[model samples]
Target chain A: MRRLILLLPLVLFLGVAVFLYRGLFMDPSELPSALIDKPFPAFSLPAVEGDRTLTQRDIIGQPALVNVWATWCVACRVEHPVLNKLAEAGVRIYGVNYKDDNASARKWLAEFHDPYQLNIEDARGSLGLDLGVYGAPETFLIDKDGIIRHKFVGVIDERVWREKLAPLYQALVDEVTP
Target chain B: MKRFAAALLLGLAALGVAHAAIDTFEFASEADRQRYRTLVEELRCPKCQNQNIADSDAPIAMDLRAQVYAKLEEGQSDAQIIDYLVSRYGDFVLYKPPVTARTLLLWYGPGALLLGGFVLLGVIVLRRRRARGEVDVGLSQDEQDRLASLLNPTPSDKKD
Candidate 1:
């Protein structure tokens, strides 16, 4: 109808408005992970401040958090307290000290309150690259079966921990040996 | 001021040392090397969003390039290598999206829209012709000849 043809521009405008509204609500920084439901990538890394090496096996046998951080990353400092709180509550937090000088990483952790069970020295970022890590302060949720359950990019805070991760963790976290 | 300049020089020197980027690969043949170039240009950089792996200097781009090189050396086919990355990084990593159930609309929607437009235009013209009880598809040969005469009468044959 002629009337329908006249109304086409309005209909298109409304459709575009709705699409732009939805776009405004989307998190531009959040990238959908492709490592979900896959086993954690294997790597052997030495301690950040010690001589012993820890492998992928060390992270399994418990539902744990693996945080990739660096001294160069300012956001890692922002999420330090949240990580410390989680660690204090008996959540075993693993660390991948990504591409930072060994002494600097050790010093930063010491000053910021070390929350990790044992930090891995990824000085060359080899393990970080294997895990598809491009930026720092990326956290991964690993189940007792050694599978990567969730990967969160950017700083993990209390709200993010509760809203995005906790419900999934409660459902997927496997039995841990005491 | 002297101290500041000295520190700046030191920092620049440190950066130069830190970022001595050396991206090298040994290909089995010229054909394989060409394929490697094509594949990198086609693969999207996850961190850089808009850049292909070949053009991006993002750390993820570097990692992807290294992975591609390693896969090539391991004698893996390009498809297998791409599949391996897709399994980890999703189809978003590929610049050329696959035609799947999810991407069916993306692949064909524009073409369908163009066809629909053509059909609609044809229908509108036909309906207008039918409504007038006459068709004006185009001017007939005789009508065209008449139009030409009317626009420019013969020079000598024109009425005085």
Candidate 2:
């Protein structure tokens, strides 16, 4: 017992050291979305490419990716081609033009081939706010019922899609179709 | 050069003032304004992470500040506003996280450690005092005789 007592400080030091060591590699920016498994927030906003309004109901029938993006965010430009590639392979993607000018958004979509099936023009970021969007290039995986399943923050390159998002997306698609 | 430097400083100060003035809102009362200020200061910016929404210049932070002001004007209580943000952003938005099962150790760990330290100190002190008490008992017979001899030496020892 006395020997164990003498080792107590060393044990505590090791425990704390191990905990802090693990914390050093953890990404602080990756905030878990509070809306996972919850239905997407309701919104009635204009489409970027057309005069018609887009809403949560329009996205409810399919398993899709709701990608929050803006023209001002440089990372979105980096992630755009990958998104285009994914869309070519028939991945349903909906874009939220978060806090961006509609004209600029339209120009960007035109300049760089558009990947989104429908783009929600959230010029004031009201829908973004409702979705708890803090930054651009955040992609959310939604199930067929418009329920958010997972959220990936920052730029999604090809590897991230294949390794992390693809499996989840495929699972949701299979569950809905089968 | 000095004049130019002074002009640049003045320009910068004016810019700062303009930035601060951009979010001005019409409050129904002074109390509501105060509440709004407090709420913004307490709510952490989800984008910037460390800064409160009031201090951050991030667009999301600005939106949150506007939301806080709107909610306050709509007569939402402080708790209601906090709940609304927490529901969207989780407890990370609040500077003070509420006590929960996961946070139980974080809330009470330091106090428990301090209490344990005091208890260990008390035990060590008590043991030391007891050890010293044992040492303070009367000397053995042989040691007392040696002490007596040293204190009151015999006449022969004195002559030597």
Most accurate candidate by DockQ:
2
Tens digit per residue, CA lDDT, model 2, A1-178: 9799899889999999999999999999888788888999999999998799888999998999999999999999999999999999999999999999988999999999999999999999999888889999999999999999999999999999999999999999999879
lDDT of each: 0.86, 0.92
TM-score of each: 0.79, 0.87
Name the 10 consecutive residues with the lowest summed lDDT in model 2 chain B: B15-24
Candidate 1, residues A50-137: lDDT per residue as tens digits?
A: 7898898888887888999998889999999999998998888899999899888878988888999989999888888667676888
lDDT of 1 by residue, B1-160 (tens): 9999999999999998754545588788999898888899899888888888887888778888988988988889999999988877788789999999999989998999899899989999999878777645678899999999999889975887
> Which residue pairs does candidate 2 place in steric collision?
none
Deviation (Å) of A144 in candidate 2: 0.7
lDDT of 2 by residue, B1-160 (tens): 9999999999999989755725679999989988988898889999998988888999888899999998988889999999989888888898988999988999999999999999999999999999998886898899999999999999977863
Best by lDDT: 2
DockQ of each: 0.38, 0.63
